[model samples]
Target: MSLRGRVLGITLLLLVAALLSSNGLVIGQLRHDLVGQVDERIRGLATVAARLPSLPEVAVEDVPQVRATVEQQLIRDVHLAYLGPDGGVDRVVRAAAGRPPELPRLDAAAVAGRGGRPFRVPATGGGDGWRVVAVPRAGGDGSLVVAGSLGVVNRTVRQLTGRVLLIDSAVLALLGIAGWFAVRGGLRPLRRIEATAAAIAAGELSSRVPELAAPRTELGRLSAALNGMLDRIEAGDAARAASEERMRRFIADASHELRTPLFGIKGFTELYRMGGMPERADVDASMSRIEREAARLVELVEELLLLARLDEEGTAVPLHLTPMDLRTLAADALHDLRALDPQRPVTLTGPGGGPPGGAPVLGDEARLRQVTSNLVGNTVAHTPPGTRVRIGVGTEDGVAVLEVHDEGPGMT
Candidate 1:
């Protein structure tokens, strides 16, 4: 089952258990109260009837008054009996023709004395189950007794119990429904988390749980944690792509730079081997070309080593980072660039803006020189003949800016 359904089901089960227990108590109390009321009323009516004159000795016309009083104050058709010394109903109110033999008999000795006495007996002249009470006359020796049939009281009790059970069941059903909705509402966040996780598993790296502001619940914390993890994963992936791109560019540039030098070396080595270098002049020319190619190859290897060092240690390496004169640096770089390609027109512009003489910037002198050399070498190798290259230094904001602008086909 879903978490919501399980939570709701467990809640409803507890509610039902509580409802049943409470209703059980109520039913017990109700039955006790009803039976008490019935017994109390029976006792009171028996006391009143026992005060009447002895039966058969009292006028028959006066019996209707006793019957009327009983029917008015208590239940109808209550059996009235006068028990003799033999303990049976000596003169029952009706003396019916077909009274059940198993019906209770009043004890004569218990009700005979001057003061009234009451006893409970089974039904007499009965159509249903019954209880009877006998009491003695207040001023005479003989007594009067009252009996009751319990059928109506029993029927009412049964109906009341049935109604209570029905109400309890109805309440439990309603509780179950309410619990289900409540659980669903509470677990909504978890469902969203589940979906987010599924999307991530499907390779949607950008997917994340929506951010929660100062979340207060466990599920909310879980969402925040998952989102944090996703952010780290995305960053790692982007870094991986960038590193791969740099590696590919490095390999391509290295191959291109080495190709010309390698071809020259091969041509010269083959010419020297084929006996074409038998003459001193041809031999000298071929060896010189071969030596130049070897030097170019060595230069390429050194550049590759410098690049690898930068990649490994970054610019954070401990190096001399003193303030340097920008004009001096630019002039020196320009002289080196012109010497390498004297035919190419190269110019060095003076410091644009500085406190005095030139802008002094903090950086490693050796590394900065390497940077200038790389730019000059790149321009010399790629730019057409007679292209103008301008190297300049200036202060932009608080930082020194170095510009190496060239006229021949600016970078691809």
Candidate 2:
């Protein structure tokens, strides 16, 4: 079943159980109280009958006087019986017209042994049966038996049961209606979350569940959690898109760089084949140009491969880390720069005049050397030939700092 149905079903089930329990208790109590009232009335009537001042003192043979005395003293629906000292039934009287089903007879021993406490006996009178109490006469030797019918008590309990069932039906109907609405309202937030998810699946990643009015409720917590997940997913998607764009740009740049050398080599080979280089010296110069372009292409390819490996796994580029002086690496880089272009004035300044054991750092020596060369090469490639370059190396704040400064027209 749906959540709303399940919730309503369970709620009604519990309500029904409670109503049934209450009805049972009500019916049981009604029966008990009514029966007790009947018993009390019977005992009171028996007390009055026994204490009658006009009752005749009669022998066992005087049945008419005994019957007359019982009829005069007893009320309707109350039957009276007298027992002798030996527990034999001496006379019986009915307050009403009919014989009233035979009242219980007491044995001789019981009549003689009767006490002030009243006792119950089953009645043979048919309709709803009867409850009889026998009380001993206060000033006499025999016992006075009084009996009342259970019909009134049974009828009252039955009527009460009917009314309880009716009330329960109405209560259950009202509760079922109210419970359905309550459950629907409770699950509305989940429906909103589902709609938001569907919108996101349809490419609206910005869609989000609306904030709940009550943040401390269970549904509110679920909404918050779902929104958090969507936020993360949207952020990840944006990052992935940016990474893909960067990859596209990197590929385009690499392709352009590769094309330059390839075009040079192809042009040189075509000229050689076309017999444009007639002399041996011209052919040798063209071959030398081809070799130079080929070496540049190979270096570019190696750099691209290294970058790819690094992208795949950061640790793919192995490094042997050891203590090395940044000053020495800087001085070597300056030497190489001057060899490539002697007129470019470059200076190195730091601790110990930028010599060995100046400004030590933990790094791979070869990688540090490559880094210095790349920085100096970038300066030479981008700046004018006469640019004054300063390569500085020092330790500050417990860190080695290498800086390359140039006096050429600086980049915008």
Candidate 3:
């Protein structure tokens, strides 16, 4: 069952138990008092009959005198009867207003044995029950059994029980309804938080629990803590994405730069094999170019390992920053390109596109060299071999600019 249902059910159960127990006790006490009043009246009538002026003052001497005294004193509705010592019964009179149930016939000897105490007599003729008391006649050996009706007590208790049942049922229903709404309102915030969690699971990591009123309240504090945690989670996710992007770019640049030196070495070897380096001067020049490309390749490989370690350990190392000319980097690319493909015409120029000029910048020399190498390598990889190339270096808008242009089929 739902919590609301259970709470209301338990409350109603306790209420019903309390009502039943309390009402039962009250009804029982009322019945006892009413019955006591009946017994008192019976005893008083017996006492008056025993001390009657017409009878012997020592003990009841005649049954007729005892019966007359009982009838006279029992002013209201009551049962008056005489029981003889020999088990003979003599019903003298009954209540005039109603047909009261008859009193049981017991041995007069037994009535005298009980010392005239009152007792209950269950109904035998199916009318109302009776509270009875038997007293011995002072004038004769008989019992004066007086009985009073229990109809009033039964009727009052039944009426009260019926009313209590109706009132308790209505109260239970009203409380159930009110409690349902209260519990639903209390759980509304948790439902919203559940929705936010589902949204995040569906890939909306930016989703957050809605804030509530009163930061000091439990629900409100929970929302604040959840939102704070989500913020950190989102930031960490974004940082991871950016890191992946940087790693991709670094791998691509390293691959291209590595190709630049390898392509130069391949060109030198192929030229010597095809007899293009016929003279010793030509072979010596080709070997020198091969050695320089091999050195640049080694530097690029070591830099790749260093960057990989830095990414893993989250540390930094100082760079070899120096005042270097962009022209020097561009001229070096032009040299390697010419060595790779001698037939291709490669030109070096300044900002005005006239001739090579100085473009000074304070930066790491190895990083700047790799940047120029990647530009030249991309040009060779995409465009056809022996394509015309232009390498430039100059300052534009107070910013150093290096441009590598090729005259071949443009990139598709």
Candidate 4:
């Protein structure tokens, strides 16, 4: 079921249970009090009839006189009966004469034994029922039994039940209506949040739930959390887009660089094949040129592969890490540079200049050496043949630092 339906159903169920419980209590109490009053009246009437002056003087054998006496003393809604010395009822007298109500046959012995306590008996006439009080006569030969009808009590309770049911139904309906509106009003913020989410899902990343009127409420907190999530998603998407653009540029640059070397090799090969290098010396020169371009192409391809691997697997590059001195690596790179370009004036300084002691770093030795060599080689490659180059290695900010400086024209 919808949330509103569930809320309304639960509310109505509780209300109905409470109303039923209270109504039952009220009706039960009312019935008890009314029946008690009827019982008291029945007992009182029995007492008065027993105490009548005419009842004590009457002879047991005189049935007509006994009936007449009981009829005279009877009050409204009360019935009086006489039991003979035997267990059977002898005569019955009512305040108003009609078809008399069906009453229990009383035993004279049982009536005398009871000591005037009232008891209940069902009427055979099938209506409300009766409250009976039996008392022994003064002479002890018989008993007087008094009964009162319960019709008034039953009628009053029925009327109360009808009224209570009607009021309860009306109240329940009003509460249901009020509760529905209250629940709907409470959930309005949630509905707004849902709409905002729908808009965001439709590619409107900037869409967000509006600031809540009640910021401290649960729905308000939920909206704030959702907006924070959207912000993160937007940031991640922008980063991804920028990364893709950078990759596209990098691929284009790599292709151009590779194409230049490949085109040189192709031209050299075509000149040799087209008989443009007929002399042995010309053929040797052509092969040498082709080898140089092939080497350049291979270097470019390796660099491209390294870049691709780094991008694909993040920083988890294969390395045989060992602690090695940065100074040793720098000295080695300077030596190699001097060998490759003998005319370039090279100098080693800092800790690597005088002794072996230098700042150490944990890394793959080959990769670290390659990196150092590349730095020094770049300096030599781009500078004038007579330029002076200095390779420095030391510790800075508790970290190993390597610096390559050359007295040459730098990149613009």
Candidate 5:
């Protein structure tokens, strides 16, 4: 069952049980007290009836006068009857307000004048039952009996039960209404937490349960705990995203660097296959260039492997700075570009004058060479065959400069 249903159901059940138990106790107690009063009155009237014949003003043989005397002493619904030696209802004197009840066959002890205590009899003609007492009449051969009906007592108890039940039903209904709202109010925070969990499952890692009133309450503490957990989850997700981005950039850079060397080697071998290196010195120079590019490829792989290890240790990759010449790097690019596309016109120049010159600087030579080759490769790939290109190399104001100029359409 749902939380609201369970809570309301239990609350109502306990309340109804308590109300019913209380009603039983109250009605039972009231009936007991009322019946006790009836017993006392009948006992007094029965005592009076037993003693009337002994008084000089009354005779036991004068049934009418004695009956009148007993009736004058009677309480409401009290009736008198006489039992013979055979324990039968020998004669009965009905009262003006009520009649006698159907008395059962007397026990031996009562006919022997031993039944002084009040006893009960079943109802007759749809009437409520009776309380009766029997005693031996003085100077007579039979017993006298007095009885009082319980109809008043029964009616009073029924009225009380109806009132109590009505009141209890109203109270139970009110409690149920109030409890439903109270339970709903209490579960509101849990509903919000449920929604947050759903949102998180749907890939909104940043979703969180809202704050509650204070951490002292159970739900408030739960919301705070859930929000804390969500914070950690979002942080972990962001860290994973950043790591993925770094790996992607690392792989892209690796591919670009690896491609440069592979292209140079392929170009030189292809030129030899076409028998374009007609002179022996031409073949030697191209072979030497191929060997150098291959060595650079090995160095690039080592550098990338070092970077991966340092990244795992959460350390930055350091540059390999040393004294280097931009002109040397530029001259290497000029040769590779000319070999890759012999139809393209390539040149080397000093930025200050018109002739190629050294542009010395402290830098990573392999990284610098890779960057220069990348620019030259971009120029060679985009420009058509026979497009003029320039590799400018010089130092100005202590900063080494290397530039690649292409006579082709510029990027949009």
Candidate 6:
């Protein structure tokens, strides 16, 4: 079975079991009560007849009235008789009967002094039985006996038992249907999540379940987390692709740069080895070109080293974080730039709040200064002779902010 059906089936089975158990108990008690009521009433009528004063003979005229009373009370197959002092029937008042089925043994010997008796007997024209009660009637010489049938009570119990079984079956079926729908409703969110994941695995990165109607449950939380994870994955994948592309371009450029210098050095070295320093001018020019290439190689290697150091020690460098004077640093850098250019001027500006105290940011001051130096050197290398540059520093909302604004092209 599907999950819905399985859950419904299990629930219905348990419910039906409980209902059967309860109904069994109820029907059992009800059957007992019905029989008890019938038997008690029969005993009561028997007692009344027994208490009537009996003469040496019971008149047939009085017998009709007694029979009418028993019939009106719906006691089936009632019979009245007086027993002689010797325990034999002396007179009988019975209506419309061949002979009633022999009653189960009454054990009258046990209750003879109590003036009553009761027992169950096999009944004719009915399924599975009857209840009988016998009472003793007093006479001039001995006592009389009265007996009646309890087939109606037995029949009523059978019908009630049938009806209860039918009701239990109907209730069980209805509950089974209800449970199936309930389980389906509960698992709807899980099914949607499953579909979303499948679509994503099939290369549909945009696939996502709508969260608006999702159940506020553990599964709903799980779906939300999955969506968040997918977002991160997509972002990381895009970054990785871009990084790969940049690395490819950098490798190509670096190879071209290195090869051009090496080729020149190799050609010049071959020329100098073949010809002894024929002319001073020729030797000097060749040496100068080689020296320039060597310097370029050295600069490339130094840049590479700086890049490596930044990667390995990016956020792990040891440094004491304290309030620093950004204005002083900017002023010193501007003075140095002016000494170098003698024309371009550098200036510093910001709100005068001595830099706000952020959660202490840690870094090596020497490395930070190197980074600032590199920025200034790059600006000087590219900008016009008289281009003006400015540095700024401030603090806002517990964060230190710095900006280097130069009147030069920012980037290509």
The candidate maximizing TM-score is 5
Across 160-241, the per-residue lDDT of candidate 5 in tens digits comes to 8999989998998899999999999988878888888999999998787888668898877888888888899889888898
Q: In candidate 6, what are the lDDT values of residues 1-412, reduced to their tens digit?
A: 7877777778887897898898889888987887777677667766666766663345434555565557656766565666555556567655324345454333345336444546666645444454545555454455555555555666777798889889888887787777777888888877888888899899887777668345577776787888889898788888788777656755664554455345445656766787845998978877886786566566555655555455445444344566554544454445435434556776666534343222223444444544554556666667887888776666556665555667876678
Clashing pairs in 3: 59-138, 60-138, 60-139, 60-140, 61-138, 61-139, 62-139
lDDT of each: 0.65, 0.69, 0.76, 0.71, 0.79, 0.62
In order of listing, the candidates' clash counts read 0, 2, 7, 0, 0, 1
lDDT of 2 by residue, 4-107 (tens): 78888988999999989988987898788877777777776667667653344443135454445444534346566666655566666444233354454565
In Å, residue 302's CA in model 5 sits off its true spot by: 3.7
Predicted structure 1, TM vs. truth: 0.57
Q: Name the regions of candidate 1 deviating beyond 4 angstroms.
A: 51-53, 56-69, 77-149, 164-188, 198-204, 211-214, 253-268, 275-412
Across 1-412, the per-residue lDDT of candidate 4 in tens digits comes to 9987898899899999999999999999999998888777777666766665434333332545435544454434666676776757666544323334565555776776777887777766565677788887666667777777777788899999999999999999999999999999977877888898899889999898888766698776877888899999999999898789768966975765565455455656666666767899977865775675577667667866776667655664467889888877776666456545556788777633443336789987766655665566567568888888878788766788777788888988
Q: What is the lDDT of candidate 4?
A: 0.71
Model 2 error, position 299 (Å):
3.3
Cα-based TM-score, every candidate:
0.57, 0.65, 0.70, 0.63, 0.80, 0.58
Instruction: Tell me the alpha-carbon RMSD of every candidate.
Output: 8.7, 10.8, 5.9, 10.9, 4.4, 12.2
Query: Quick one: ranking by TM-score, best first?
Result: 5, 3, 2, 4, 6, 1
Look at candidate 3 and tell me the lDDT of residue 392. Answer: 77
Prediction 4 TM-score vs. true:
0.63
TM-score (C-alpha) between model 2 and the true structure: 0.65
Measured by lDDT, the strongest candidate is: 5
What are the per-residue Cα lDDT tens digits for candidate 1 across 286-327? 677567557757867777666656764555334678888666
Better of 2 and 4 by TM-score: 2
lDDT tens readout by residue for model 3, 179-288: 77887787788889989999998989989898865899999899999999999999999999978987897798677769888888997898888888889998998798
